[model samples]
Target: MAIALSQLIAETDQLLDAARFNDYCPNGLQVEGRPYVSKIVSGVTASQALVDAAIEAEADVLLVHHGYFWKGENPCVTGMKQRRLKALLDNDISLVAYHLPLDVHAELGNNVQLAKRLGWSIEGGLEADNPRSVGLVGAPAQVQTPQELAAQLALALGREPLLIAGSQPVRRLAWCTGAAQGYIDKALAAGVDAFITGEVSEPTVHFARENDITFIAAGHHATERYGVQALGEYLARHFAIAHEFIDCANPV
Candidate 1:
């Protein structure tokens, strides 16, 4: 069985609305493909390699977090952008993306998925004021040392997570999935012992050192890979479609 692109778009749109996020780009069906989709391929970013892989797999829809047409990004389809777009268009591969919405969704979000993997039960979002905040605040199923937590993350993500353990065990934790160092203050204010995100900035090192909270920089792509994968699986199960994840390694 296969779902039409229009039906998929409707499902995605409903999910985005329920998540309540201010998205960076359009959330669904960014590129059009065939009317019916049996195979859905998902990833963190819509890079050239991912596009090529999706085309090779004959994916009807390519889902991702970081799609084209970012606010400050060059609008012109040139160089890498042109190649990626051409690959999708030439193959008639529909591009479906959900950025902040995917990160903030309570059930299918990156933070929630990561928390579930690590045996954490989410208490609330890190930002109490902003209901749509991407980071989450939670307590682990059982208290574990910072080192133990880092080890768990490494095992789960298949990469060594950079840990800056402070003075205590981690019970209360805050987390955002990718390139979210700027939210350190929000996590700190939530009074979490540990804060985790992907891609630490230079200032993040200093902030973690001085803030008296443990910080972990897990790989951006690795941390984010789960949410979209979970979403793809959900789509597959519900619509009776086939789903696969195209993993593209990214250190940052």
Candidate 2:
């Protein structure tokens, strides 16, 4: 009923090909707790609220898309960080996270999962030359106006997206989940009628207008809630362990 924590981490690392990505934060086990794991709580981010939820759920491991020790973050454990880490340590719950690796994985990645939910058929990567590109180029089952696409996103994500309408109808679309407005140029180069991401910058509107491509800014947390859940389910089935996905709502 329980598997060794080291084995779980090793299997997950290989499953997501974690080491292949030069991620912003460290992947795999960020905080070690018990030697074995029987239950896992998966979420979009390892926030304080999520940590508390995991503790309440009596989880042995907290699996997340975002974890601690970012590339440029303050190394010191203090303030908010101190409290969050303290809670996990006190509860004896190991923390495991995967960033870009979770975004680009073919089956369980955020982009692919979003496409599956929205009924979009993925044609290829947004950057056709790059095998590791996180953004994807795809199309819905039917052609739709920018407004219609926005409505579909709002309905599916349970959050209304900010729409920057363009002159053309959306026949082809490009998308990258979670703060990927910066990939708009790559989307444009792909000749898609619209680009979708979790957040939009001020200049994103201008680019969409001048380039005649629609832009949609869905919520970052809303857009990326699926991958970690899928990964958790996989681990549970593979190891015969229990998994629960806890959604700690974030309006952003």
Candidate 3:
């Protein structure tokens, strides 16, 4: 039971509406491989370890949230990049990636999936002006104190979040996953009681303090591990393929 690689990629592109996004890297089918895909391994990033794991799983496709050839990364076919690409090519496994599209998809997205796991009810986009905003404003099932929220995140993500105990949830919060610390301002604009993101800068402390809002810095890898897995499961169920989520953990 398998599907054509081209068909799988095409369906994913449409499902995630990848063409609508202005992403740093290409959205779908970053590396071409065999014509058919029977097994897929999904993960947060397409690192060497993940590729090795995919090869061990006999995966025909490596689908991930992060892929190579970023907007300003060193464009050289040497060293680590060379090794990774060589391995994928040698194994004849396709690499499919979705960056911003995976984050913003209404269903099977990082934001939505994270919320589903944490029992957070999404209200709207972080940016009031843009409905397609990647960051999300939402509320947990129950209004919780900063400590309670931190505990919840820790339990759910398997990593303790860096909690700035200040404002307690008054039924609303905002969040964006994977190194979106810069979007703190956008979250503030959403007027949330707390802001949750993968990482935080020094200035984020001042902003959270000054504005009486809580801040939680959950691990980037932890926060973003769900979207690709969700996508992979969906693909597997639809196409009669095998899917496994490979977690090559990064503490960051």
Q: Could you arrange the candidates by lDDT from highest to lowest? A: 2, 3, 1
| TM-score winner, 1 or 3 | 3
Q: Candidate 3 local accuracy as lDDT?
A: 0.91
Q: Model 1, clash count?
A: 0
TM-score of 1: 0.96
Per-residue lDDT for 140-250 in model 2, tens only?
A: 989999999999999999999999999888999999999999999999889999999999899988888888889999989999999999999999999999999999999
Q: What does the lDDT come to for candidate 1? A: 0.87
- Tell me, by lDDT, which candidate is best: 2
The global C-alpha lDDT for each of the candidates, from Candidate 1 onward, is: 0.87, 0.94, 0.91
Q: What number of clashing residue pairs does each candidate have, in the order they appear?
A: 0, 0, 0
Summing lDDT over every window of 10 consecutive residues in candidate 1, give the lowest-scoring window. 15-24
What are the models' TM-scores? Answer: 0.96, 0.99, 0.97
Residue 223 displacement in candidate 1 (angstroms): 1.0
Task: Please list the residue runs of candidate 1 whose C-alpha ends up more than 4 Å from where it truly belongs after superposition.
Answer: 18-20
- Candidate 1 lDDT score at position 21: 53
